[model samples]
Target: ADLSQKSHRYVRSEPGGPPGKDVYSLLRCRVLLGRPYLIEGNLLAPNALHDFLLCDDPTDALETVAEDWVTTGHDAFYVRGLQRSAKSERGVYNSEYIVFHAWQALPLYRVDYTLE
Candidate 1:
């Protein structure tokens, strides 16, 4: 499937906002799908809630375009994408290195905790 053809919307947390306040942004991203096993490294990070990894190098990172998409119960789909380190003509990375990044959905809370 050519995942990059579609624009995916994602909710991202704004890094710097009003003190003691949380802000978010809706991002429309273009991504390419790939294999799930292509993700390298460990699932847990020091203090991160989601699991992700950095490809060994730029070429390896670019392969993440084939990573599979993960869907959450809240109806959010997440996966990794190849981002260029610097801007290039026509969105082509050329010789610039690529970065691998992924997304995750926040925890969901059910109003009715007890089962009927």
Candidate 2:
């Protein structure tokens, strides 16, 4: 549960600044040990980030809603790296979700990275 290595970015919507003004924050974190652990307490709350459940492989049957509100309207917040499931029939598998609020924040349409 140590988030020391994690990096975060915060953005606030301007203009009228309505109640609960759409605020967005990006957190980059890694789990030394892979598993589905709860990262944020509340997904729809302000300054909340998503949980990440890392897995060795991917699953197919799991239907993922890329645009779910829990993803904070960020396409980068959805599940990834799921190509096989060890416990496919048992329905027990590993995954991760970038949890966030989506009401006021603009959608995260894309993510780009160059491997080192």
Q: Model 1, residue 29: displacement in angstroms?
A: 1.5
> Candidate 2's residue-wise lDDT over 1-116, tens digit each?
12311221223333443465543344344323222322211223222231324221122223333322432222333233332542333221233354333432444443322212
lDDT of 1 by residue, 25-98 (tens): 33333433232333322222222312324432222233223344334211222223224532232222221212
Off by over 4 Å in 2: 1-85, 89-95, 98-100, 103-105, 108-116
TM-score of model 2 vs. true structure: 0.17
User: Which residue pairs show backbone clashes in model 2?
Assistant: 50-99, 53-95, 53-96, 58-82, 58-83, 58-84
Q: Of the candidates shown, which would achieve the greatest TM-score relative to the real structure?
A: 1
